[model samples]
Target: MTTTPGDKFSYKIELHIHLDGAIRSETILDISKTKGRPIISVDDDGQETVITDQESLDKEIVITTPCSLKLFLHAFNVFMPIIAGDRDAVFRIAYEFCEDCAKSGIRYVEARYNPHLLANTLDKPAYARERGDFSPRDVVITVCDALDKGSRDFNITVNSILCCMTHQPDWSAEIVSLCKEFKDRGVVAIDSAGQDFEPGKDPLLCGHKKAFKEAYDNGIHRTVHAGENGPSEGVREALDHMYAERIGHGYHVTDDPELYSRCKEDGVHFEICPLSSIITGACPEDIMKHPLIRFADEGVNFSLNTDDPIILNNALADDYVLANKMGLSDEQIINSIFNAARASFATEEQKKKMLQDLVNVYGEH
Candidate 1:
């Protein structure tokens, strides 16, 4: 049976979703119109297509089939130019994420994004065309303010994680600082985003490494995107070098028997995005042979997630549907929910409350 929102479950926990990747198409269109920014994107053939409505915008952002990670990332280039550097757009997206989570019965979520990607402070901004007064620090502040308000207004707990892109290790120190500064305002952790190192290639122990160490020293939680498109060695590097408390899309960890055993023994949480794994070519096409099934069968600590709903054209429910299709029993599915709650970076008191709420919904784990 498919676990749709508000169907089988009354409450849920999601740990791996990108805030920028989940923006509503209608919101993007509305913001573009309001700012007088043209909604245009270049197609595979190099022809520019003018997006005039929600349908066209969705066509640009949503991935309908399996694709390489590189192609999947290109979806961001389609609309981020309109959303990034805009204060209202940034706030609205963060706030609306809460509303969407509530609708999906997600009671607690740790939404992550790169503040630098959203800011227009640098001479060469990540997405924005022109430099502006808004800095990465301002992006964190805006997201915190919006998430705080959204959590209160929507009656769901929401927290943010600052991401450090692999290409821009220079931003890692500032990201960790922002995490510390906004700890009271709902920023919970530091994350490594963007591309991962290829197999046999050593993870760059540069500024990113230093920042992660600082976060570890200061009590900040850490997660890394490893072994999704990269090899299992990347997962080893993340754990050994970056001190990752959680592994994001760590499917390829299974490729290393020793590493996989270590992770399972250590209870390292894997944020498994089922639909995303398929569509992003991070795993095999057959659901029956998916790593999530192996994780479930082996009793690995893992949580299902909709990694990028807007891009994947899915919801939390869609992820559950895929898990069900993979023949995961309801017991396993519910266990994944509990796994997410236990692995979350929330405070001990907060985790206690969240675990109690999960038991209330799912009935004694």
Candidate 2:
């Protein structure tokens, strides 16, 4: 499909996606049944209702509700058991995520997950017997292999990042090592994800400095989650201290002009997930009122992404449509795509190829 200069261009690169957050609902049900966990239910109205042995609630518990930051983090905890067990399960999730991306017209993407969380949940009984020395490095490797195979199989490109949860200091070194191990196998970068639960806890406390230093020293790229649930200081810390090349959900940066200016000057990209931000209460209710357009207008480079497409009921197209609704012109939308391509961890040659592909596809009449 040829795109006109004035027409909407679907440039396909997703920089801020979460792996577990992208699992299909049917897959969730299948995994729940296979793992013998509590069955999730749906009402006549077609709303999901998950009942646990520990608690009971009648209404559908939407993960995208605008609540406190803690509640937003709790949303993903429900899916841990469903996604963490078998290699095939992870493979299937990766496959389905890619399928969804294809349907959304996303040509390339970087999906992030903390393999430590997946490993801890999957290897508990086995590791208990082995005195806890067993690493889920194999599982991480398997997931990467699945991603590689899926990319070739589906004719859609996808990359992954071993997200080191900022709350877990003990596993930082191991996660960094995993990134190094998978450096050549399409593991493009490292991420700091999950909730910043404690106010006293520093955003850099998860040994991100050490992890980023190690990854940078080893010639790996870094992207850190900051300013979503914390202050602008957290964003600054990620850039200045942890050496993040990209900041995920940096909505709070609107409050700090100096930090915003620095990011623009340094060419650090921000992966802004609009629907996810609305669902997680990162922004005010309206999309037009979002600070994303302001940032874009100010020349703060960023890419539109579906942070948790499944949970937010969003897709790449949704992000683009919302961008238009937020008063961004076609050229501005194209600029966002270019920002994503520029921030992508793909090699310079690969990036050039992708950019050329985009220009050829969309630049044509």
The TM-score leader among the candidates is 1
Pick the lDDT winner.
1
- Tell me how far the alpha carbon of residue 31 in candidate 2 is from the true structure, in angstroms, after superposition: 2.5
> In model 2, which runs have C-alpha deviations exceeding 4 angstroms?
1-9, 40-61, 121-135, 197-206
Tens-place lDDT per residue, model 1, 1-365, is 12265457667899999999888878889988989988889978999988989888887788878999889989998889998898888999999999999888899999999999999998899998789998999999899889999999999999888999888878888999999998888889999988776534545547788999999999999999999988999899899988999999999999999999999999999999999889989988888889899999999999999988889778887788779889998889999999999999988888999999888778887
Residue 62 lDDT in candidate 1: 88
lDDT of each: 0.89, 0.74
Q: Estimate each model's TM-score.
A: 0.97, 0.86
